[model samples]
Target: MTKKTQPKSGSEIFVPLNMLKKSPHNVRKTGHTAAEIEGLAASIAANGMLQNLVVEPERDGEGRETGHYFVTIGEGRRLAQLLRVKRRQIKKTDLIRCVLDTEHDAHEISLAENVIRLSMHPADEFDAFALLHNEKGMAADDIAARFGVTPAVVKQRLKLAAVSPALMALYREGGMSLEQVMAFTLTNDHARQQEVWQGLGWDKGADAIRRALTEGQVDADDRRARFVGPDAYLAAGGVITRDLFDDENGGYFADPGLLDRLVLSRLEQEAQAVRAEGWAWVMVTPEFDFRATSAMRRVYPSEPELSAKAQRRMEKQEAEYRELETVADNEPMTEAMKARVDRLEAEMEALRGQPVYGPADIAAGGAFVSLGYDGGVRVERGFIRKEDEAPAAQRREREPEPSEGREGSAALPERLVAQLTAQRTAALREAVASRPDIAFIAVVHAFVASTFYFGNRVSCLDVTVRTVYLSGHAAGIDESPQGRACSDRQAELAKLLPAEVEDLWDALLGFTQEQLMRLLAHCAALTFDAVVRPGSTSSPPLKHAEALSQAVSLDMAAHWQPTAANHLGRVTKAAIVEAVREGVSEEAAAQLADLKKPAMAEAAERLLADKGWLPQVLRLTQKASARMLAA
Candidate 1:
């Protein structure tokens, strides 16, 4: 119009770097974060700029060419280049490729570019990562550097891409989820993955998918696998399936048979060493149950006595620890003093539980060898099988007078022993009621006994301290830490208890004061019938149980945690969301609200894993129930 031919819309042009200004018409109001700028800079540095900046000519107020441009869509890229220029890596006059637009509204053009963009689907990312590694021969570290992610993340994505292609198709089609895809990457067995996929109908979750794929496999962390170290098992031709997504996963041994053989081989070797100690006989089993020896008798080895010097040291340490504890309660002590107290306590623990049985007991009794939770060999001594029992007259001399109305002294039937223990438990309760401190200690002892060991009755006490066997209602309860502890203690005690009720009196007299207190606690613990009934949860006994829980500072979190199998999966989707909201945060709950129940449960378990959360009933305070109900 003014003797100058106007440039056509959608024209291509080259703009100088220093001449490009951030467009005032940009739709994005929030400025890019420093991390975003740094990442963008890295991407450009590694591989030169890939996207074109949308820009228009900047006109002076006099309507004259200003030799400048306004960058519309790629302001982030413009900044990244400026950063390169500041580092003297590029000149300010470097030409940038840009699309010049004039016809469309500037703001509308920017908004359209920002709004129409779609993020690359995670499935595409997985495949892309795999292609770079497989076709281009790029390592995980190289790919991660280009993408600004951890090498572990790149490996995880590469593994994800290796999942059954059919399953990946399903993931792309929205028929499956990212989590399900990740779970399928646990193994590269395409046939098994497809088999599991077909068998699973709907509402499938990562945990269920993983379980199906790993069926018949033992976790590398399993006691059996641990007993036979992973390297040893692998050397025996065992295969392992590992999860790339789980950094902490120890992996699953695909051949459990091989692992079992190795465990047995190792245990037998340990048994050989134990047999050299001169036992009547040594038996090796994968697991030894004290319950299996209820028909047997256990003879004691004369208790070991501490040497004079050791006894003096022990007493001095105990006194010092008590004094430090006293001062700690009244006022804070110096760090050095507190540390000294800790050292003394540790020394006492090291000295306190030395093996009570002696060489003579080993000769008279056989030992059972098995694996402990940590995969260490456990040798349980002092069991007298019926065939190994002493001569009748000698055994009779070992046992003294029978309780009133009880006849047999040696090898009385189990039913009679039970009756005698019941009677003695009643007498012990009456005795404990008059001695409140002993009663409280007995109760505490009952719980501690779960962590420690010893439980049986030659009528000293058949401490069948059953506290509401929740195993039926809560599957895998027996496998829980607290549950296993209690079960193991009960079995060990059964092996040690005298088979004859007539020997009960002499056995009780030999029991240490601590041992007697344990028996008393066992008796008291058995009487606790405070299990919540269908409609009687608020009964008087439960109140007393609550009081006792508070007194003992019973923190259930240490004993149990919510797992997909134990708590979350059994509850409703709404309940899972609420638990996440309460145990974590509202935002976290919102993230899970859209997930299906099974997936939500697994997600909730991960979220609450280390949070140390518990339900109202598990809380020590009785008021917790009221507060939860009100909420």
Candidate 2:
């Protein structure tokens, strides 16, 4: 009887290609085809093999033999290497380097070798992971440790492997991430997946999806928003005046840092409206504030004009029916019925396409600023920059002739100009004087469109004001209206009032730590889970171990809130529990309290003032969580 033993003498040895055997334990499949093999061969020719192959000593019938080796691992790899050497006409003896060990424990060596090498590409790794998990039945943590990766990464990659090959290829090519792939996987419909995937590929598709994600989803009544698309409005830092719009059933503001949640809230509200009564999508932009075309409100044979058209149409239909009745004697009644249905459908289609008097058309128009949704609906209460400026040629054509005594060829009516100028001044004055509690105040210049056809069709009126603090001293700036408005607004508003111009500017910079906490209190309907170090039993609800990787993602400790969080979950859950306890699914309960809603909206509006809400959003995670969460 012979016993297997490690070769102390011939550890460094060579194995001939023919004698070496492939390992049964090896599972990674070679994706390389003939051309790839040749290219790899060429690379090896220029640079010799960099990695050593593991082998086992050959045995005889008695189970005892010389210490020379036979390959137990890297069989395909060795074959490729040998093919290259043979092509170069290199001697077999020249390939002198390989490590040999006993055959008795060959399986363990093969497993150890493969794990140590970790040479597979992502696709290969996917397969390897599948083998390790599905075939070998290893635990996720064990697999993670074996591969030096987080368990989440392993799960995510495995998740990616399950995606449709087309979508997986997009991920492999860096078009999407594991989370995105995971999201895509939730939609079971192959056609829907394809639709969404292709839609994402379009130049505007991603923007649209992003808008939907950020705004929550549009519903019937809310769909017809008073702004260009929600994406654009939110981008512009839409300060939703939720408080002022209430009758009893509706009206509430979205919390700062909760645009997506707010959108969802709004959608649910609109959906309730639809259930109560039918509603349609209304996209309001600075240019147009209602659907350009709506079927519900017909324009063709306008409602006012429909009765006469209906009578005439009925007469035509009756005549056609009579003719069909005559033909029915020769043909099937089904044919006549089919023909009638087709004719009616065509008429309906034509009528549906015609324009109607939308909310925008019915609403009064002026220089008042307004919010528009879907690039067509405007929420006019104040000034709204027009979506479409009159083309230069059109504007020039519309210009009035110059006054006889004016130096310029054309002059504005002094009366009209003076009136507008005075109106702007008064607005500015009102804005400035309203703040008395604060120490200082200022009015920056305001920009307004003038009927003036001259250079720079805009006029600016800038003013600065200040008040003493506890000491009879004051401070304010007038560099630009922006700077001036900010300094003065802060001076007047104090903490109780909504952020003045300056507070809005700061909020745009990002939610301060305190502000994020305040937002969590205000927007309590969303849910999120919290994760912490396994051993950290005493950690603060909001704080985490500084050394752990989780804390690294959340760098600003004081201002720690979830960044890039897209859904409501535990972190949200914790926030709701800690701040507000209304059920996440209950929109009405989640709606800000009547007294608190205005203050929250004011804070949010100020937060959105200058830069809009997007910059503030960028600071938050796409996934909401405490400091302990990580993707």
Candidate 3:
């Protein structure tokens, strides 16, 4: 029978480095590279092996003790020591202190030592690094070198450590995730951090926290900021907050009031430059809406003559361009020909720079200079304010009074004049209804006169187009597709008409029947009123407008749809649900009914999109007969 050997208890002992062999049953499957081993060797050489290697005494089949030991733990340290011995830094007979055991399972001990050793938590590591920075007076680069990390990584860790103490406590207590903790580092306001943390529930995520923190602040990427530039804003003593953990495009400006002031100051400076050009007045703003200059009269700028030198240069470039074109048409195209052609075109463009306005016209007109959407300066010249226009009575005194008409309109009293105009309007309507061609011409003339002459006496027709201003605001009213289409068409037609009012009749005679019909439709569209007046129902006018829309087959869905920015965000939760229920399916509305107002609005916007739905104000009436009855 085999006899059992007595187990030996663990004890600290000094073993020769050459006698310690790495165990095959080591838990670690990968070993360090040559460079890493070198680094460790240098560390061990300087620190004298701070940790002890765990080893087991080698045994024979007869249960007898051997002089050699098998390393169960610190296999990496063994390799590093071997490297030092090969470099002749340590002798082969040098002794390494180790824990010796004779009975313990080497595999079990190795596994426990590797798998159970806990790494320091990232939060604790961040705090430690911050301490090294603040207490030791070490810079980021120095800390990074000591810790074997990049300077940027050290900076990021320090930023995380700079978060509010309350939030850091929450993180340490396992109440907040690492991402949530990182988001709180965007701002240095301790109260705000606590408020956001207390206000948010589990459903709100890091993005929500970031948005809440950045509320009322402008993004650095905004056009206004881009126009004024960060340099200028910083020069004006503006403070900007940064997000070190997340890539939010340079973060946001903390002081929006300062940003606004800087923008205004820049705009005012630009306005001052424009004011020196002899204008009657110069208006400046960061942005101007469509309604800003809607009621103002616009004057046209006259083209300026070119200088003698510029004219000669332009003529020479033109001649060169023609010669290149002739050569290209006759011979095979070459790079030299292309180059010459491009040069001539560039020269011509340089000669055709912005036109210079005359002093006389500049004195009589004004301009609007503002920051454009693309961060460039936009200048709109030759706008005459209403108060600056010449009085009409002053010029009329030089002309003779018109003779009395068949109704003797001039001699009539004010009330009688109104009565006579009422009768004449009825007669005119009947006459226009009888002749479609004349009606088309009359509407076109009236519209053209109003557009070009600013409602002056440019048309023979006496019909006046009615205007209704809504008391309540509607989203995208001025920027709707229909409005933009009409504006574009008007601009196109304006380019074709004569500058003088007296030549309008001759220009009208030149239009084809199709052109006249298009012009008439546009003019007719301008006369329709769908505004809801204050303290009064707009049912009659709206009903009439619906009829006109239906006759023209207006597609409101093509023009507009509900969006969070335009519609849903502006209304209450109940209104949003109702809109979804009417426009989309009731099931969709029910699904969104339980959400908060902002969340419900966002969901409704998504659900209603591409559904071909419109609000009541935008929808056209069914037919002309239905609309006429309502009217």
TM agreement with the true structure for every prediction: 0.55, 0.25, 0.61
Which portions of model 2 show Cα errors greater than 4 Å?
1-10, 15-21, 25-50, 57-70, 74-96, 114-578, 581-631
lDDT of 3 by residue, 554-574 (tens): 776776789877888888888
Q: How accurate is candidate 2 locally (lDDT)?
A: 0.41
Backbone clashes for every candidate come to: 1, 61, 0
The reply for model 1, stretches above 4 Å from the true place, is 1-47, 53-116, 126-167, 186-195, 219-222, 225-230, 248-251, 269-281, 299-304, 307-340, 343-356, 373-377, 384-517, 520-631
In terms of lDDT, the poorest run of 10 residues in model 2 is 445-454
- Model 2 residue 164 CA deviation (Å) reads 38
Q: Which structure among the candidates has the greatest lDDT? A: 1
Per-residue C-alpha lDDT of model 1 across residues 1-631, encoded as one tens digit per residue? 5797666778777888999999999998998876677667778878988888989888889988687889988999998888778878789999998888877899998999989989999989888999999999999998876765678888898898899989999988998988888889888889989988876544368877887678679977787877787688778888778775554438888987788888888999999988988888898987765455556656544334688888898999888888898999999899999789888888987776454554555656788887765668877776767665554124334545456545453467888788987898889889979997655544544443332222332222333454344544454444456656765565555444443444444454455777666565654554466567576648778888887776666678777788877889888888888888999999888888666676677778878998888876687665644544555
Candidate 3 lDDT (Cα, whole model)? 0.73
Better of 2 and 3 by lDDT: 3
The sequence of per-residue lDDT tens digits that candidate 2 reaches over residues 293-322 is 111111111122256677687667667767
* Per-residue error (Å), model 1, residue 72: 7.0
